[model samples]
Target: MTTALIADDEAHLAQYLKQQLAACWPELEIVSVARNGIEAAEQISAWQPELAFLDIQMPGLNGLEVAQGIEGATRVVFVTAYDDYAVEAFDAAALDYLLKPLKTERLLACVARLKAALGRPPAVDESRLAETLQRLLAPPVQGLARLRFIRAASGDMTHQVAVDEVLFFHADDKYTVVRTAQGEHLIRTTITDLAAQLDPEQFWQVHRSTLINLAHLVGTRRDEMSRLFVRIKGHAQELPVSRAYVHLFKAM
Candidate 1:
């Protein structure tokens, strides 16, 4: 039996995908399920499964990073919630991808393709994967409208804040705090959800719980402990930069 692995942060979604895979390809054996990209990378290294179903966005390393870390050939089927632009990129590189809220028919087609490919020799083109990843990670080109304003709540009042005026976002319990020069406002959205909606070039996730507006970034400083902290213009608060994301400010 062919062994496979599923990596997704959402437990429900991962289980659903596994169930669908079982229905479509009973011969495939799922060896493990990973909760995050870091765990997925570890499992991939240890088991080296023949196939991996990777979620595009995760806490640690993203799916593309995990795929690049694999030592041997492993067929990857990316799962993402992105729209047609990303789908077109996947198609251009001839890579397999499954859009979110996956349909049975679409999955069946993917399974059929996987089965056919499994019968043949491994044909993973590194160059193509690299090109695809580059396109996926890069910020969107000009002319595309980005998030201009955010609606946040303060007490019983709802306020619309311009994106440019925002300083940063912090994950607090079940809600996210939108900080600005004026004050802090609460939003029910999670940082992960906000990351998808914000402009990549304008906002950068410096830590798991923090996403900073790049336009307001003053500079980075290293504490006595050698930990990196980011300073934003007009904000006395300094944000910690997690090791996983420290590379983002290397050139700055």
Candidate 2:
């Protein structure tokens, strides 16, 4: 039996897709269902399913990023809400792209293609997909492109924190902490992943595990051990600055 993975941030959508797949292709077995791109990547790495149905937009990491990280013969079908332009791009590149509000006919066609590709050597050019993802993620010149809000989880509750209110971000073990004037919230995204999505002029990485908002920066001080620390405008705690990033405050 061919195993598959369904990855989408929406739980309902993932279930709907699974039902549709089961109805159309009884031979296909869904090995896993992921709620976010991070979990999806982990499942893909662990199971290495024969096929992956990845939603384009997801928390922690987008579908493109997850797909790029995948190796070997796992065939990918990107599920997107993007317009015809993006669909055309994928079609022109010979990569499968499924539009949102999935139709049964469309999914049936995709399943047929997957069945044919099963046992065959991977024909998809991942390099081309990487280039396409880069183009899609690039911001326009008219304005700065950055996340306006972050969805953070705290135990059983989820909070939507505005980006401007964030004081700093620190990596804590497996999760990254999003600190704001109110308090700190946990996010599944890694520090490295958050760095790429934030505006460089506003958020600066002072250490390997710490990123601070320049608006909240008050000043910098050196300790007795010659260690550099950054002070926040209204916050009491001082964040350490690594030697690699100390050059950022040399002029100050």
Candidate 3:
């Protein structure tokens, strides 16, 4: 039996896709379902599924990084909502993909191709995929205006801080902290919301509740146990990087 794995941060979306896949390809066995990139990467490495359905913007490593790290024969079918990603590039690379708001018709076509491809040798070119990811990351997603400033409240005083000055954004109970070299301010905005508004190239989500400005990054540190932590310029404290996002700093 052909085995597969589905990886998406959204639980409901992953379950829905599983249901749809059961209907579309009843014979295929879905060995695992992962809710984050780290989980997905580990599962893929352990199971070595014949196919992997990867969501492009997953938490932890993100889909591109996860796909890049795969060393097995698992063929990938990208599941993404970002229409800005070049469809022609995916096609040219012989990579199958399903767009968000997935249609049964499109999925059926993708399933057919995958089924046929499995009968032959894996033809995916990892180098091509890497190049594609490079291009995709270079261009900013259109239609979303990058946040230039934040208005936050600190005790009795409200302050306006330029987005560039922000060292990091950390979740603190009911509010999020807007930290800069000068000081910190509390904001009602959630970390997830801030991530969406911030420039993709500048701000990187290091944890579920933390987003750091790469420009202000001092360096990374590892403890005795080899756990990773990130240091910010002008900030005395180090921020913990989640296990899932540790791959982001491996190059450092």
Among these predicted structures, which one has the highest TM-score?
A: 2
Across 120-225, the per-residue lDDT of candidate 2 in tens digits comes to: 7755544455445445654333443678899987678889999899999998768898888878898888766677778989998776568899998998888765
TM-score of 3: 0.54
Candidate 2 regions off by >4 Å?
A: 85-89, 92-95, 139-252
Flag the better candidate by TM-score, 1 or 3. Answer: 3
Residue 148 error, candidate 3, Å: 33
Residue range with the least summed lDDT across 10 consecutive positions in model 2: 135-144
Tell me how candidate 3 scores on lDDT.
0.79
Candidate 1 structure quality by residue, lDDT tens digits, 1-252: 999999999999999999999998999999999999889988976787888999889987787656655544567788889867447545643237888999999899988898888899756454555455545655434564567899986678889999899999998767899999888888888765677678889999776568899989999998765667899988998887754465567777
**Model 2 residue 45 lDDT score:** 66
Better of 2 and 3 by lDDT: 3
Cα deviation at 114, candidate 2, in Å, is: 1.2
lDDT score, candidate 1, position 1: 96
Worst 10 residues of 1 by lDDT: 86-95
Tens digit of per-residue lDDT, candidate 3, span 150-211:
99866788788999999999987678989898888888897767877798789987765689
Candidate 3 residues lying further than 4 Å off, grouped into runs, are 86-89, 92-94, 138-252
Comparing 1 with 3 on lDDT, the higher-scoring candidate is 3
Model 3 / residue 125 / CA error / Å: 3.3
